[model samples]
Target: MDDTFPKIEVLINNLYDLKQKRDGNFEASVKRVLNMLMVLEKGLWRTTRGNPSSFTDSQVEKCSLQLWNWAVAENTLSTISDIDNAKFRHVACKLLTLSDPSSINERRVRLQIEMCLNAAQAWIVCGRYEMTDDLFELARTCIEKLLDGLAGQHHSLSGSKRMMLDRDLFSIDGLQFQCVGSLGEHDKAVIAFNCVRDKLALHPKEAPFLAMVCYNLALKFHKEGKLEECTYWLRQSYDTGKAEEEYKVDSCQQAKTLRFLAHVCLQWEAPHCWINALNAIELAIKEQPNVPGFLLYMKILTLSEAPDTDLISAVQKILKHNLPSDLVFNAVRMVMQNGRESACKTCLPFVCESLSHTTCGLEVILLKMEVALHFGNEDEAKKEAEDLIAKHHSGKMLKEMQQEHMHLLLWGRASFHIEAKCYADALVWYELSASFYAPGKLDCNLAKLYRNLATCYLELHRLNKAKESLSKAHRIEPDNPTTIFLNLRVALFEGDEQNASHAMDCLVQLANQEKDSVGRLESLPAEDQETPC
Candidate 1:
């Protein structure tokens, strides 16, 4: 005889009738039933001043089902509508009252919210950004209301509330962060991350969640150029998220964090930092050994003044592991760095064989060409360069091979021409060498190139060109006593006594600058002092 009881009973019976309908005709009947139930549910929700338990069990269940169904259908309709769907908004508002956490059927309510959350996500992925935002805001509002309703019923629903809160926190914050990150609003993305960290801090027992938030925060800090803070957060994330026997954390995630930490350490460039990176990478390899870690470790070792024997053994082990091409390229570089040309010889067969399997083979070939050049094996360098040029015609490797090999070939040929006293031919090759390696910029290589060019010009009796090239070489690497002395000799030969005296003054100043042995400067051969022209 209760006034609301009869209305609840009628709605429950109507839902049951809709549930029994054939699938072919169920959609239309279910829509009609949902509309009636939504009105009653909303009125009851507003009138009831306490927890959702103020409603009867049958009423709660019927309301939850309708909310779930309406959320699902509204999501579908939003997808098809070009404009914002006002119908979906009305249904979502009704859902807010039905999803009270204090209700005896809290599990059902939670499931309904979860369905709506998923539907919202689907809408977002399908490019309905506006609708997705609206749906998310509604869902958040509903969850907040549910949390408020459960505040007085903490004893009855504490565990359930905690679980729901954790789920909602991760989902909402993660989605917001992702959306902001995609839009390149890094500042907002960082704020969202800090909010997640704050929530996790309140729930200290959620170590895995805390760790994930910290990891993301560290990445954000890194992007923002907060290196010290990034390091701090990365360590916290790694320590908290480390898998215990009970947790069984994801190995790949752990490895990613470890690699990131290692890279940061490597960037610091302290010897101890490199050592720490090596240790961290070793641990990462234990969890999920991959080519990247191996290669990174190799680079660190090669750059460090570490023992060659151990580094070589480690590189050999990596090669034995059937690593990817990029990793194999690192291994070859390690071999070359250690001055282990014999070790390099041993690796070439495997490296060449692996090249076919990976796009990095060209890189390995170019590295081998550099190694060959370092060892003064022009034939080997030429062959490797030619092979690489034939296989990969356009890329960093091809360009490097063309540039480096041209210089090596022309320089070697020029050196021969100089030795054979074919001064004109040597001048041609030396000019070609300088062109191949132009325009001179650095101290060592540019000085050497200009010195060679000046020698060829002197031999060809082009005193003006010789003096010009020597002056250029001196300007680039001013500290070279040989270049200064050559300039003096050139000034004397050209009968420019004033410039010759200036060059003499420079030579004496250079001699005084040589701290260890002024005798060495004085011992310059007479032939070197005399300009050929």
Candidate 2:
């Protein structure tokens, strides 16, 4: 209803209904549904100034009421138990497929693999192992494709997607050190749990995930009232988390462990666990109370209904210190959480300076760009981008990284122009950005990007360019009415009666499809309440 993905939502609904029926080949329908979900996911997740409001499940949902009814029964979403007992799981397995890559986009391939992994995981959680092997195979294929993207001979290690694949150059005292970024971890774990029973002891390298797994197991035990086991595993998890810092290996996100520890202390009722969790986070205050990691912990504590006096003191301490940029940014997130966004905006300068220097740092700088766009600071954003490009073109980051980064930077700059209604400038930036996409790799933004280009060209009276861009968009997403309508505009602008007539005919056919879908929904029994317009 918020119109986050208005045009695609309609297509998604139609596909949702088709997939749920007792007729036709469900495999095709399921793939269609998954493909649409993947597209919608990417479209809605673009950068925003502050917190992204479009990220919530309800805001970017996959299932419609008329289809995937299993997902709608419970607030947490339908589980295995929610599946219709009447239907055979083999039948369900036939329908729940690993969708093929809709486009050659690296992100799209990643999403395809993720979709399979997610489906396999849900089935696993529901004790449905029948389909995991097939599902895992699908995930494995995508990962291979992902590696191919990373391994292209011409693609230097500097590219953003490939950057994570680079082995960081750090070592100490006869031991190699590195950051974590493995796509195979999920399928490997699933296979190990399913088939490999006599595996070796947990590897030292896997300690981070071990801690996470143990902590989650502890929560499960706690729910089952097995307090002793719960407490033991929680301690193990906490100890492992503590080791992460000393080890200097990037297993978990910064401040995640402390936040988790604090969450348990505040949310769990058990006094023993509470004390341990509280103590763990409180100890962090001694290390760097003015740092982002510590301030984040303090922010977590402040969320408590009955925050301790010391917790309140920690927050005050953060304010008194001339903190580092990252800490100030963390403070901004905290301040914003308390409904003080204006105060956070005032702290953006510090946030911009906090970006790490080791990597291409495009993502970090993009955050600043987004905030600038949000606050309507065009000059500041433009200046920031210019300085970044200066550093990039000067070989601060590799040319390959600069090349990949240029696309995202262009897209960000285009967004700024769009906001100001500078259509010509926006079109140029988008065209440049779209050119930088990896050859053969599908860009999720392809359709929308060209569609915008078409609009911009039209505004400038460049009818030929507008028609060409719209045609390209049509090739990417042929069925989308939004693209079709814009294509109609191009045709009309050129006074091409044939193309205009064709576009209008297509629109009518699409409208009829929707009308027919509605009629079917209306005919269903009133109790189903399954239709979603």
Each candidate: RMSD to true structure?
A: 15.1, 29.6
Q: Which segments of model 2 are wrong by more than 4 Å? A: 1-261, 268-280, 284-357, 360-363, 386-444, 456-465, 471-485, 502-533
Q: Write the per-residue lDDT of candidate 2 for residues 173-252, one digit (tens) a residue.
A: 00111101012133343343222112212223445654565566556656676555555556655565455344432433
Q: What is each predicted model's overall lDDT from 0 to 1?
A: 0.63, 0.50
Error of model 1, residue 512, in angstroms: 58
The per-candidate count of clashes, in order, stands at 0, 4
lDDT of 2 at 449: 74
Q: What is the lDDT of candidate 1?
A: 0.63
User: Which digits, one per residue and each the tens of the lDDT, describe model 1 over residues 345-379?
Assistant: 76777666756456566666666776776676767
The true-structure Cα RMSD of candidate 2 reads 29.6
